[model samples]
Target: MQTCKILQDISALQVLSINISRRCFYTTTTTSPLPWLFVGLGNPGEKYQGTRHNVGFDMIDVLAKSHGISMDRVHCKAIFGQGLISDVPVFLAKPQTYMNLSGESAGPLAAYYKLPLSRIVAFFDDMNLPCGVLRLQDKGGNGRHKGVRSLIHHFRGNSEFARLRIGIGRPPGQMDPKAFLLQKFNATARERIDVGLQEGVGALKLLASRGLTESARCFNKEQKYKHIRVQTLET
Candidate 1:
């Protein structure tokens, strides 16, 4: 009887091993594509429309219009839209939680989608670059931007997600930074921003078609060259 008991235990172990192997196989063979989440950080409402701080929202609008994606859904505290770009699934969001609390919307949307941090990209304004200049980086800390700081906090201090910085330039000569952000662009600035938005759309299309790394590499190189020329001309 003892010998029979030992044999039964061995048989159970074999069954468990088979089940584990099958589970591994299933996991390894699954090939469903994960969608990319593109979040634009900005304050909601018409009060902030066309302000320097709302350029991120402008980007989302341009992208939606270009792709025919309707921004009619509210999800995770954001105006959300989803569509296919070159057969790649894409989700666009403009956080309605305002600029400072943008994470309240972005973080939950990422969690709800179950996307890896690598597949998430945020667009927001930056004062460090020249007006209408843009930069795309894989990951970085918040560059004194409250919206970015909030996102970092909600991401549990994980700054591994991607971001595209839309430059609004530094506040002019002692001008209050906050006031500068809320101000509408002048005609010249508006023209530059419009051009920047068009370039941004092209970069995003490349991102959807190729990927973050390749898109960032190509886009940043062109932007850097353009920036150098602008600086040379200014000086």
Candidate 2:
């Protein structure tokens, strides 16, 4: 599995307003009234597929599948595709650079589209929460995530972006963070993730068609699955 880590925390509240790139690509096809750039944050390559940290990629895959779009090509140093949800143009991207350089790919893409960070939403994993949970925030701190840090850097200190954090839970016992994120989810974890991915796609649909505030209010902090423990008395 592919693994990487970032060494700093970036607060979205401290974004700057400069260095915006000048490139824009328009989708002639009409899908939705609002156009957005959706970025799925994760390392690139086949080895990382199915890992807990790749949940962002997984969510994008789920959304593309639902829209009958295939993410099978490279563009802007990432895999990307275009599709419309409720007449809104959505550019889906999976950064080619490893997680730490995710912003390098995303920043240019957003700037090229003439879109503000506000229209750009990133999906990524969060270790502070329990597995199978999802959080949607209009704007906030990066929580020390490498990909988000890089993105903030690329934006030159812009924090108006939307972020969707999927919980992968804390590492087991004292397992290394790198190792834990690289590990595949167990059967139960996969089931929970599958359902969560579906929910994530629905949230994306809402975010693209509706608005961030509406989408966050509807799906943020909502869990698609619940964990129930069964105990048996000693016999």
Q: Mind sharing the TM-score for model 2? A: 0.81
What CA root-mean-square deviation does each model show from the true structure? Answer: 6.4, 15.0
lDDT score, candidate 2: 0.79
Error of 1 at 202 (Å): 0.9
In candidate 1, stretches whose alpha carbon ends up further than 4 angstroms from where it belongs are 1-29
Candidate models: Cα lDDT each: 0.89, 0.79
lDDT of 2 by residue, 6-113 (tens): 222232322321222112234333442546888998877789989988998888888889998778778788899887876677889999898989988898888776
| C-alpha TM-scores of all predictions | 0.86, 0.81
Q: Candidate 2: RMSD over Cα atoms?
A: 15.0
Query: Model 1 RMSD to the real structure?
Result: 6.4
